[model samples]
Target: MPLDVESLRSHFPSLASGIAHFDGPGGTQTPRVVGQAIADTLTGPLSIRGSSVASERNADQAVLSFRSAMADFLNADPSGIVYGRSATQLTYDFAKHLSTGWGPDDEVVVTRLDHDCNVRPWVQAAERRG
Candidate 1:
């Protein structure tokens, strides 16, 4: 089936405001349902993930549900689903982990078109490995 671009775009309320957001650390525009879910979770009765208390159970369920949904979307195992505070942090962490197996013979190439956050992590990782 053909993609419904307009229908997908309609879900993001920020797109209607006619402002382009470019801040990498800020975050991308989220859909209305996603925004609502985030707001609800932030304002909801939440505690440490557990089953002893209602708040804890709710928080635990929310995390499990998110992991399940993301796993389904990515066609990956839910056990492997990882969440990071930011893309930059995740990239750095992943680069560090991946570069452990690199040798002096290996080459790490980054393009100028990429953002600094994307480029710096791999460069630093390669330098560390070398």
Candidate 2:
């Protein structure tokens, strides 16, 4: 089924500006409710994530719940699910890590159709390896 973009837009205040955003690979405006939730959490009884105390346990649960939610959404193990600042950062990090296995003759084909954030990382990583 197609998603209701209009319905989704109601939660994102940035959409009110009538600007179309396609730069989500690097950064994107978060929904207003998400921003509100974050503010609420920060202002609430938050503490370092651990099993030592009530606040700590709350923090730990938040982290674990986020991981679990992401895992369920992706249909992957929670242990395998990871979050980064942006797709650009994750792609760059992975490219750098994967480049160690590439030989001088190895070629990576990143289409021009891809966002620059996706293309530059691999190219830079491969160049660094070479």
Clashes of each: 0, 0
Q: Rate the local accuracy (lDDT) of all candidates.
A: 0.86, 0.82
Q: Summarize candidate 2's per-residue lDDT along 21-56 as a digit string, tens digits.
A: 775542367888778877876777779888988788
Candidate 2 collision pairs: none
C-alpha-based local distance difference test score of model 1: 0.86
Candidate 2's error at 116, in angstroms? 3.1
Cα error, residue 66 of model 2, in Å, equals 1.6
Q: Who wins the TM-score comparison? A: 2
Model 1 off-target regions past 4 Å? Answer: 1-8, 19-26, 113-116
- Per-model TM-score versus the true fold: 0.74, 0.77
Q: Which candidate ranks first by lDDT, i.e. highest? A: 1
Give the range where candidate 1 is weakest over 10 consecutive residues by summed lDDT: 19-28
lDDT score at residue 126, model 1, on the 0-100 scale: 95
- The TM-score of candidate 2 is 0.77
Clashing pairs in 1: none
